[model samples]
Target: MPVLTAECDPRNIASIALLKKLRFEQTGYAEKNFDYGGIEMCDTAYFELKRKT
Candidate 1:
């Protein structure tokens, strides 16, 4: 079986809702440092959907 994966910004409620509506399950989240302006830590939400046989 195969799987589909996606990553979205946790702060974006609309995107999160959209993913849920599409039957995507939230696997986990990760936080990493980003260099936007100077330096910032950002959290990312992970989602995945298993293919139906």
Candidate 2:
């Protein structure tokens, strides 16, 4: 089996809702460094979908 993984900013409620609607499950949470305008620590929500066998 394989898994599809993704991460999104925790503050984005719309994205989170969309992911949930698509049947992806929240796997974990973490703080990740991102370089949007400059390097900064951002809280992330991890999601994953496991392939049905």
Candidate 3:
């Protein structure tokens, strides 16, 4: 079996677009996703590649 994933700052439009072009399906999201610097927070989006048969 083969699989792939896309995880990155949700603010990155280019990256998100590229992932979609690569056939990854958006699956999840989170707000204030993590503590980047103990002061600043970040948002994130997750995508998974479609399984091939």
Candidate 4:
């Protein structure tokens, strides 16, 4: 089976590096509004991950 992972958290440098090391590529992405403490915000970013062979 193929595995997929997405970086939805903010400013995760280590995770980005690890994904790159694992040969992950940026395919496509999407975002939506999230409410926290009565504030509306969204996690904006591109998707990255590797597929298992």
Q: By lDDT, who's the top model here? A: 3
**How accurate locally is residue 25 in candidate 4, as Cα lDDT from 0 to 100?**
67
lDDT by residue for model 3 (1-53), tens: 67787798999999999999898989999999778889889999999996888
lDDT of 1 by residue, 1-53 (tens): 89999988899999999999999999998887433465677788899999999
Clashes in model 3: which pairs?
Answer: none
Off by over 4 Å in 4: 1-3, 29-53
For candidate 4, the 10 contiguous residues with the lowest summed lDDT are 28-37
Off by over 4 Å in 1: 33-39
Shift in Å, residue 17, candidate 2 = 0.5
TM-score of model 1 (CA atoms): 0.82
Alpha carbon lDDT at 38, candidate 3: 93
In TM-score terms, candidate 3 sits at: 0.82
**Candidate order by lDDT, highest to lowest?**
3, 1, 2, 4
Give TM-scores for every candidate, taking all chains together and pairing residue i with residue i.
0.82, 0.80, 0.82, 0.46
Tens digit per residue, CA lDDT, model 4, 17-40: 776677776564546544545765
